[model samples]
Target: MGTFRDAMSYPLLRVGLIMLILALLISIAGFYRVNKTYSASGTLGEGMHYLGDDKFENEYLYHNRTLVLYSSNANLSLLQGAEMTNYTLVDREITLHPEERPVIYVFNGSVNYTYNATAVDYPYAVYSLFAFVLMLVGVVMAFLGYTQFLRDVKEGKK
Candidate 1:
């Protein structure tokens, strides 16, 4: 009991709290930017249309569903699922819901591609699910590091 309270007496705990809040704020910012209404500029290279193996066959669309990138604080991975109703002049932005997670489907006649997403009941793809778990681990590590630093300071016999 005394040790835990003593650990909280250091200033680093305050710093940790600030950092944790900052992380959450940054997460919210990212969530907002991605969920905004679709714009023409953002759509130009995001998706492409292609015909089946034979040009005369039916056409299919390929979307850039995901990208995994690292940031200063954490690794950020994005899986975008779009629902397109019309072929030309696409209308209504399609979003991949958490429930859909990862689905097996052919994109632009490519069978190797897969759909992986975040916040799903069941994660169908390995990479998509790994990223989310990574983020959660990072959060836990940050808290542990912060608290550890504070504990070390409070225990110093100065």
Candidate 2:
């Protein structure tokens, strides 16, 4: 405990604590942004086409009706539990029937596809989780540093 107190008295330790707080705030913001992007849904089709955000590398398409070919730049991969299709990708679009398959599109860059189906964006979810872990570590470090600093101040008065 004494050694920790001595180490926390340094000016660098205070700076580290401040940085940790900032990290926590940033992680929270990131989580909110991910949820917002994923929850927002709109129509994409002949009349109303949906354009993918440049920041996102993947999007999920969900529905239980007709399957239609829409234009997109991303590679479509059927997610697990989704109906398998032998449809070929041609002219940047492929038509599926019965809408029984849930497809997840993977893109090297950003993508813009017709959005006749519900879209779920989660390209940044992993990044958000990573940030959350970092924030947790930062909080623990800051708490220890602050506690030691307080102890040192009390001892100095004695």
- Tell me, by lDDT, which candidate is best: 2
| Cα lDDT for residue 123, candidate 2 | 49
List per-prediction Cα lDDT, in the order shown: 0.34, 0.46
Candidate 2 on 1-158: residue-level lDDT in tens? 34555665666466566667777666656544222222223333222223334233144433323344433333344433445433334446554433333454443323233333334444445666666666677677767766657667778831
Q: What ranges in model 1 sit over 4 Å off?
A: 3-6, 34-158
Off-target runs (Cα >4 Å) in candidate 2 are: 1-13, 32-99, 102-115
Q: Candidate 2: lDDT of 100?
A: 36
TM-score for each model: 0.25, 0.39
Among all candidates shown, the one with the greatest TM-score:
2
What's the true lDDT of residue 83 in model 2?
Answer: 54
Worst 10 residues of 2 by lDDT: 39-48
lDDT of 2: 0.46
lDDT tens readout by residue for model 1, 96-145: 23222222222222122222322212122334444455456556655775
